[model samples]
Target: MHFVTGGSFHGKAKWVQEHYSASRVAEGWFNGYEDASWETRDFTTSLVVLEGLEQLVKKVVEENVIGGRAALRGKLKLWLDWEASEPDRRLVLIGTDIGKGIVPLEKENRLWRDVTGWFYQDVVMAAERADVIWYGLPQALK
Candidate 1:
């Protein structure tokens, strides 16, 4: 599994596409920005890209998932298992760096940021490769 993160509109999707242009021929991309329903997505392709992680986290916060991080971790574990089930399969997670900038004025927004930050940390720790993009440039973190 590979994790890619960066600020909003920082070219994260572009970088991931170029980085995996070869394997992307048969990739499945779940654009969470438009719809954060990845929990119900079924993957048939070897390369699965989950973009707009921040929005998904926001959804989680809005829904008030019980156990919060623990529950999210369990959900992530399911994807990890899916990736491990297929030797040739790849899972790429693209999240915006919402932890930066000024703190949110609203409590819900703050919770979203906090949970997203923690989620990113967990993914980075578990991912085989981690990268952070800045101004369309990528820097390897793992």
Candidate 2:
């Protein structure tokens, strides 16, 4: 598992595509992976790029709310476990560094920031490799 994060439009996706050469890239929002058909596809032989995770965090935390953190984390873990099963495949995750910059004014925005930061911490901990892109340059964290 690889976690690639950075400020928005910092070429994280370009780096992933250049380095990994994926068959397909999946956008994140993580909208419906918990549904009954989540297990239908095997990620082997393909690289899955989960881009815009902070957007998902915003939706998950600020919007209608999806079950709660436990439920959301459970689904994430489920997906990670599935990805782990296939070494030949790769999962490249790209999230904007929402934790940086000035904090938001609204409570909902603040909540989104907090949740996204915390959730990204979790992902970095679990990831085998973590990279942050700045001005199209990638720096490895772990």
Candidate 3:
């Protein structure tokens, strides 16, 4: 699994697509300033937490299963329950507009930026590898 994240209009998704040809990508946008009603920070954090949990479940299931007919019934129930709880299993996550920058005027906006930046950091820590793209150049941060 690969997680690509960057600031606004940084082309994180494009880089991932170019390298991996990801068949599926899940995007989470925390529009902090635009919508006042939504808890964008909390939502983004939940999404990242869910992503890590789902990945762990996948690894567990993959490890338990072996081969043909027996594999189907071996750990199917355990895996099924886990899968049902979290259904969005994305192979790749392209998170855009998440970065650290100037402070916002509103509390929610400030919270959103801080949370998004933290979320990105958490993702990078959990990921096997992470890359930062700047000026059309890729640098491995982890």
Candidate 4:
């Protein structure tokens, strides 16, 4: 269970793919006050989202006291339920356009930045034991 995220074109996914070749990355949903979707949400939202996921994971691990395939399945169901309830949790979010500094707008642009930022925060939390990749440079950020 790893979450890879970063600003647009930051190569987060590529890095993950390179490492976890067999891992599956899925897209999630968004629930924000603004119409720009991910653009306006704040970092706190990302933190909450990640915290929710961690809680869910803990629940799964606890339920899987027996430690078997059945328990794993049950834990997976827990994750599915969480995703159904919170679409945002289902996403492998990425921000591909934030190198030029903040955009000059108050609607979609801002929303995108905020959302991307928050998403990245969540990814960091979820993938706490993550490795940061920049310009082909990889660094551990746990």
Total clashing residue pairs per candidate? Answer: 0, 0, 0, 12
Report lDDT per candidate.
Answer: 0.87, 0.70, 0.43, 0.40
Candidate 1 local lDDT, 28-53, one digit each (tens): 98888888997667898888999898
Model 3: clashing residue pairs?
Answer: none
Q: What's each prediction's TM-score?
A: 0.94, 0.79, 0.49, 0.40
Q: Rank the candidates by lDDT, best first.
A: 1, 2, 3, 4
**For every candidate structure, what is the RMSD over all alpha carbons to the true structure, in angstroms?**
1.9, 4.5, 14.2, 14.5
Name model 4 segments beyond 4 Å from true: 6-10, 23-100
Error of 2 at 16 (Å): 0.8
The best candidate by lDDT is 1
Residue 12, model 4, lDDT: 59
The 10 consecutive residues of candidate 3 with the worst lDDT sum are 45-54
**Please, what are the lDDT tens digits per residue for candidate 2 over residues 1-142?**
7998998879887887777754333432221223323223454444566767777666667545555455457757876887777666566677889888898899888877888887888889889899999999989899
What ranges in model 3 sit over 4 Å off? 23-90
Q: In model 1, how large is the Cα lDDT of residue 80?
A: 96
Sorted by TM-score (best first), the order is 1, 2, 3, 4
Query: Which pairs in model 2 have colliding backbones?
Result: none
Winner on TM-score between 2 and 3 is 2
What does candidate 4's lDDT look like per residue over 15-123, in tens digits?
6545544232222233221122332233322122221222232333344433433443443344434445654543333223343475757554454444444434554
- How good is model 1 by TM-score? 0.94
